[model samples]
Target: MSTKPQFGADIETHHTRFDVDRYEDIYVVGDVHGSLDALKRLISRLELNNDDLVIFVGDLVRKGPDSPGVVDFVRADPCLVSVRGNNEQKILRGDKDPDWLREGDREYFESLPIAISFDTVLVVHGGVDPERSLEDHATDELLTMRSPHGDGYDGPFWYDDYDGPHRVFFGHTVHDRPVEREHAVGLDTGCVYGGELTAYDYRNDEFRTVASKTHQDRASSKVVDPA
Candidate 1:
């Protein structure tokens, strides 16, 4: 494991690379959005073992109840890791601050990577910059980007244009279901909006989802103002 750091907008962008074995049961989860109960249920369904590793695509906080509980849960677990999401970046950039975050929780958020690479799969909160290589990708873009525009093509999502040697597993843009392209996958199924929290198991090439336990009215309001 090794990390490269880049600073943008007063936040540090940490990128990590991992060399994972083929047999390892690696799982990538979509945006959690502070749905701790849903997250727990989703994890339980995985039946994870000592060898299994789970990586969250981010937005672990904000827009649901028990943001602190989510942070604390992941923090205490060694097998879980996260990439920085737009929501996490927002808090870092001073857009909003919830009372749930503890001092250590803030540090944990700051330490999260902008991207995580394992084997041939790259995990990020948002889609990548098509114009730049992974190493040169901008930190802000990694956290907040939804789509990329280029060469008179005015209206297509980022995954539509992706031609990659590495399979990208990302979360950010909400879709009716998990969007799957040849080279990329969009896993943000709007878990905070009374939708399901999803997870992909790379080893088995499977997807698992747990339906939201939150009320739509309350969840919608929290999506706008997480504080």
Candidate 2:
């Protein structure tokens, strides 16, 4: 919405369906606050192949210029798998709704899943809350929750000490650019907030970035050696 986001406690709107495990070579992006132009530039950079599965870490709308455009792109792309971002969740749950969209947008935002738990990792918009079980986590928790003591592996997109086989990738916190923790990694790059939008190449363990047009945020993509 046009105002600052307010994530409410009720989370039933996110009780929708989701993917059990349907991605690989995942090209995950962080917090796209309606930067349709920047998103297009990043997508063009990908030159994605049919096998390159794309995962979006949510917050794909609001706070930027083109909320509707972002949704249109995500809907058109077959290779893309998106989770319900915190902003989208706010609209879906009717907590602080804004006129960011004209019409038909609510349906699109309402359709997104809360989480996509894979064999390797869990993909979410904001960090997952550790206070509840994976199944116990409400859509609100998955959509708009973050924890400070996220060093533990109780949830998907929060922890910094993930020692499991798969790595959790997400966005929402652009304060720390390219945070590489053991439990989870944040790649927001703050593109829409004058930060660069980042992409992590999992197979090659590489990072790539495209500068934002609206903002001057910058990030030099680097590989994090696995411990």
Candidate with maximal TM-score: 1
Candidate 2 residue pairs that clash: 59-85, 160-182, 160-183, 161-183, 162-182, 162-183, 191-195, 194-215, 194-217, 195-217
Q: Lowest-scoring 10 consecutive residues by lDDT in candidate 1?
A: 218-227
> What TM-score would every model get versus the actual structure?
0.85, 0.75
Model 1 gets an lDDT of 0.77
Tell me the lDDT of model 1 at 211: 91
Best by lDDT: 1
Q: Which stretches of candidate 2 lie over 4 Å from their true place?
A: 1-24, 130-132, 148-158, 161-166, 215-227
Worst 10 residues of 2 by lDDT: 1-10
139-211: candidate 1 lDDT, tens digit per residue: 7777766666531213366777778767889987776578777788878877888888999888788889999
lDDT of candidate model 2 versus the reference: 0.65
